[model samples]
Target: MRKRYAAQNLLFISAAVVLFAITSCKKDRTTTNNNTPVTATPTKLGLYEEAQTDNDTVYREVFITVTQIGTLTVPDSLSDQVFDTGSGGMVIDAHYILPANMITSTGFNFTGDSTVVDGITITNQKHIIQYGDDNNSTATVSGNLCYASVTIGVTNGNIVVKRLPFYMYYKSVDNNGKALPPHEFDVFGANSGYDVTFPNNAFITSPFSYFDPGTGLTKGFKMAALGTANFSDQNEVPLTPDVITLGLTADDLSSASGFSMSQLTESPPYGYQPYIPATITYNGTIVNDASILFDTGTNADNYLEDPSLNSRNAVVLPTNAAVSVSTTSGFKYAYTVGKLDNLTYVENPQYSGVPVSIFSLNFFFDNEYMLDFTDHKLGVKSN
Candidate 1:
């Protein structure tokens, strides 16, 4: 099942969860391309420096890509075969093909002349549909595409083929609740090098509304709809009705490998709540509840930002251990507490060289944690 976190209503009150705060500190010297050490003043503030009203202004965007593999043959008599992006690749439409058709049954017995070839297996199916205003205007499929192979028939003879085109709409929104113009693109296949393919004579209807670039709102369409048609009957027959519901898939955060949260025995004695047990080593010392953020967006090496604990360029350690970050976005950089750790100062310039302690997301290195927005709790576990 898919879990939804209502973060807007929940107030994050972890004093340890330091918001962006600025302080003055000394600058660090870095080596140039020729390995010559160059001293430069640090002015950029880290994310957890202090809490700012405009923090919420930053919005995160998620992109899901779906691809269709193998070949499907549909007779000219039957209507379009409806497929849905159910939760985690689960198919919701009645016309959905199941594994039984390929694994057990001889072929798929849908309306018209639709049939699965001998070697093909229906490994998975999903409907990439979404809800909300943009969704109301345009239709699309979200999530990764299904995968399968042609195990039986020849690539050419006795088979009808048509490449299905996948389409999606994109809308960029600012912090304010304002609509942005819509963008459209076809969801192409990942490795097959082709866009999409389905049976010949199959009807394709995409749920996408044309966006007015000037106003960033829907031009004319309302909510996009999905339905199957029986082309042979002359009358357009709808397969299933479209409704707003949360699609559940077997793939979820809990199912991800190497993710766990546990209680720690050794914890800080004062001003810290030990909700989850985790260990981060800095200069060979372990720190707990070090105000770690599991950001799927950070793209830098290790950096410290506490202005009150360490020298401007002084090393910032977890107080003890090693580190890891989430790989959802991209595993390009793994921020860690190196030997000469120090917090950077932002805000005032006079307090340079002052030792300060800052919070960072690099503390959760190689650990799996859960953010329970329902109960407003964060659980951490390490493997």
Candidate 2:
């Protein structure tokens, strides 16, 4: 399940576990040239989207495309099925997906299915339904499934592997080390194509937004390095995610060729996303319990923006106070949230009572945001 937001941008998908009912699929159809997995290689993908704020300020989304225009060949049963051509759902952490509505081309919509190839099995898979806004949107899908042969070319795509052979988003395991099968949202991520993928250990963004046509800069790298790396440019600060083990799929049961998602990753494919500590201080009231996701996706700066606990509520700064955020990685940012001139709440209650703060695409301002998946740490280097 996947969704993207405007004011409260969220790149991470929440985990869900349930049973799905399988429906039969028929007819083969050709998928559009969409997210195709690349062979592992050091490929330079250009930056993605750019957004504008109320004050007319602009911010660029930081994701680098991992796929190229490629064909998606579907089975005969799904041939007449319509695939999403515009505004399909985004990948969870890194997979492409669609809701029942997006694929209604020939009046065929999303339904649970059981797919088996040469005794390899991934069954009871269903499409995701999105609810709420970015600050707190939720996805619902069932699991006990792996390896969907979607047109995206099973298990091969760049950053947002919008296809099958689903890899990420498994959240359960059995005593014998078999995956309980949570949900398969991603079938892409540095699997076969090593060339375009970042070199292991580390890679750093060029400390500039993708759309920032710098006045005097011309190195042409919005992002860089990795060994001690899941990187290309070379490194200093280490970035890694804190493993939470939301779900697990035994390596043996995961592939027909005995392929395990861990083969391409420094950690088990089940590791939770990495999060770092952030100390948020507003009006001298410091909240040391805050945590921040050092993600390459868009950020809402702080909850002080349009994304508060709920969509129906106005998320203004506390008393319009000045705010300061200090990360454990050693960067401090100061800003102030002003009263709103426009107020329109959506009655969305996804994050109704939870607190949130994010490092926006522009938050890493004048420094390098380093990610070290192997070590589970995030590093920041002053530019």
Candidate 3:
């Protein structure tokens, strides 16, 4: 009787131990912070090819989406600077118009996800377009939409990136209206990198003024364009006007000797007073009666040539021609130029002055020029 009673008690204790062990494991798993779910690695969206309009509008009209965040390497001079992908990213925008037939889908899974992650915010954005009526000088069209919030590391020289990942989605349909399978961008990764660097400090002055669109208030803008130049066609011909204007010496030309500035043949544009007369030598040829404007509102590299200058100066560059640039400060750089056919030149009747040619991205990036917004000056270095 004693042995049997002991056996029964042993069995009961073993079952209780098993039950306790099972309950403890369930409790630990449910409360553990380490078990939180993480988002899966993203994939790239699509690839694009450069396209042109009948009027010579140049666009990268291809469809693409970023699937991953990849590393961007900068110049060795900046090698000491460590850029964190999660926190140091900047917003990237592609202002483009898509085709009517293009198929698109929103990743519902990402809908409420943090628009900003590790300093990267990927979001959809738009711009407003005000069309001009018949009474107005010109009519406007729809503005562009883009994907924003990609982070980047700014380095000198060529940007060297090894593992920047982009997850994008795309689709093509058959003759029927049925939808096709979605595909991600895998090839666009090759051309997605950018090269950024700084220039010599001596070339520019500081305490620049910038325009705040949000405030509509003019404040000190830290960035400035060193000068402006125009692009030529594939044949190396100037796409627009040949006459170059030199804004008065206060901007740059004051101390430099050579050439002459003259009063305008007619009342100049509304905001512009007669520039203190000046002339400049361009491409070894002396040009007079030119209007020079150091426009901060302009992109610092290459911009579309004004249409008013179109018929005025159409000097073609030789096939595979290279254009050289020089400034009164003795800054110099050169690049092969290409024509932008469809870029429209806005000729506002209220502003009767010939459009000021813009020197923007083409020149800055090609020349390895850099703008220090914090210091408020433009700098250039050898490429």
How well is each residue in 172-263 modelled by candidate 1, as lDDT tens digits?
23225343332222211111111211222111121110111111111111111111121122233222221111111122124363234322
Error of 3 at 353 (Å): 11
| Candidate 3 per-residue C-alpha lDDT over 37-99 given as tens digits, one digit per residue, 9 for 90 to 100 | 332211111112122335644322211223223222222222111110001011221111122
Over 4 Å off, model 2: 1-43, 49-59, 66-113, 116-123, 127-270, 299-301, 304-314, 318-321, 336-356
| TM-scores of the models, in the order given | 0.22, 0.42, 0.27
In Å, residue 41's CA in model 2 sits off its true spot by 9.2
lDDT of the candidates, in the order given? 0.23, 0.30, 0.23
Off by over 4 Å in 1: 1-259, 262-279, 286-289, 305-309, 313-369, 379-383
Clashes of each: 63, 57, 63
Question: Model 3: residues >4 Å from true position, as ranges?
Answer: 1-150, 153-315, 318-324, 334-366
| Candidate 1 all-Cα RMSD | 25.5
* Candidate 3 TM-score versus the reference: 0.27
Give Cα distance to truth, residue 128, candidate 3, Å. 4.2
